[model samples]
Target: MALEKYSTVLKMAQEGRYCVPAFNTYNYETIAWAIEVAEEEKRPVIVQLYPGYDFYIPLKVMCDAAKELAAHASVPVCVHLDHSATYEIAFAGLAAGFPSVMIDGSSLSFDENVALTAAVSRAAHALGCEVEAELGHVGSGSNLDDFATGGKFTDPDEAVKFIELTNVDALAVSIGNAHGAYAATPNLQLDLLSKINDAVDIPLVLHGGSDIPDEQIKQAITRGIAKVNIATEYFRAMYKGYSASIAAAPDKDSLFEISQMSKDSVKEFLRGKFNLLKADV
Candidate 1:
């Protein structure tokens, strides 16, 4: 497998029982190590970078490293621009060589989201970059109210309409899931997820993959979630690894040694995900 179109990768995944984990990376270490781990596990993976990190690292630099690494890997990798709020941002991502870009208009009215996403889908397709759009609003973990409300969840009928209107490669559904650490254990609306999966033909995405129970994650996969976005947990793995390495080698370790030790943890974390996300069939 090599660097490939995200749409191709995800569409293939939609046919399987497991998802292709999309790991969010803000640094070179994460990207390089992530692909390496994917190679070790022999599983397809998606590498995503949020636009907010552009201030810290240039988008060109990020995309270049991810693409180059994926080109040489033994397993498939898809470079993606995650969560662009507008067309301009989505265009920037495709221009920067991302094979896929997500245009998020979840905060807008249905018609508005349709217009914005449809426009992006048109432009992105022209450039051969696939588009992913969010239907229901996925909110922050701090506000439990975000996931608790029934209206906020994706309506199966509306999901069908949204996909027909936008023609996105994937749909990110809000099903009792939130970003970052959960205020309390969340019971993912698996029933709603099933309805959405039954309603649409495209791959379904589950944001906030972090902190969900393994059984529930498996259930979500069984129900038709093809892409799982894991962010907070991966960052925490890196931090936990590096900090523990430094603490244990206070007198003997250099930055290089600490990073080498840290890769162990990152590798362990990634391996767990790759194994878990491997299709059941």
Candidate 2:
């Protein structure tokens, strides 16, 4: 499939009993590994980058990499901006040929959030890009330090209002999810998620999905969670791979071995997710 708006991919997940993995990337090697696994499994995945990551690797390079990966990959890939805090970055992402972009105005007041998100939605749609916006604050980790907020749940009624006002293609609800690796297992607000799901017609996204039990993840997907954001687990695997590589070779570090090890580690996690989601190649 050609590169398309995330709305189409997200809709497919809802109707098909699956959830698309929106994987975060930093370097070219990580992005390459993600695309390789997605292509090998023939699963639709979103390559998501954030504002902080934009400094490490310019947005232009990332989008170009994503475009090239999508253009030639065997399966489907969508390039997206993960947590855009302001309209300027959102507009930059739209102009960079991203197929989807997220506007995270959850830190703002309800009215301001709606207004800013509406503006972003308009700009993104005009460029043929899908827009995803957050309803409630999801805490920070994985370099999302500014996104942190205490345990707050999105009001189902307010979610409906936000959607109506913003006209976003997808909604990312807080629902007790956070940004980084949890110190303990997170208590996912399944009931709250279901209420929001029932309130809105658009696809729902779950952020900070790392460390959640597989059963809970599956339940979220079945109950209308179309997109799941995963970052910490991927970082964990990379750290594990490098640590093992260093332990095995006390003298020298093989860059190739390190890259392949990280790739193998992530592939195992992703393959299981694709299978559980009932994604077919």
Give me the candidate number with maximum lDDT: 1
Which ranges in model 2 have alpha carbons more than 4 Å from their true place?
141-151, 278-281
lDDT of 1: 0.89
**Cα-based lDDT for every prediction:** 0.89, 0.81
Pairs clashing in candidate 1? none
Q: Candidate 2 overall Cα lDDT vs. reference?
A: 0.81
Instruction: Give candidate 2's TM-score.
Output: 0.92
Please give the distance, in angstroms, between residue 205's alpha carbon in candidate 1 and its true position after superposition: 0.4
As for model 1, its CA RMSD to the true structure in angstroms is 1.2
Question: Tens-digit lDDT track for model 2 on 1-281?
Answer: 84756888888777777899888887777677777888888778888888678777888889888888788877778888889999998988888777788999998999999999999999888877789999888875433332323346788999999999999999998876778876556667778888999989999998998877777788788778888988888777777877877777767667876666556666777776676654232
Number of the top-ranking candidate, with TM-score as the measure? 1
Model 1 per-residue lDDT tens digits across residues 1-281: 89988877887777656689999999878998889998887778999999988899888889999999899999889999999999998888888888899999999999999999999999999987898899989988777887766667888999999999988999999998989988877779999999998989998999989998888888899899999999999999999999999899998548888999899888999999988874445
Off by over 4 Å in 1: 279-281
User: What TM-score against the true fold does each predicted structure earn?
Assistant: 0.97, 0.92
TM-score of model 1 vs. true structure: 0.97
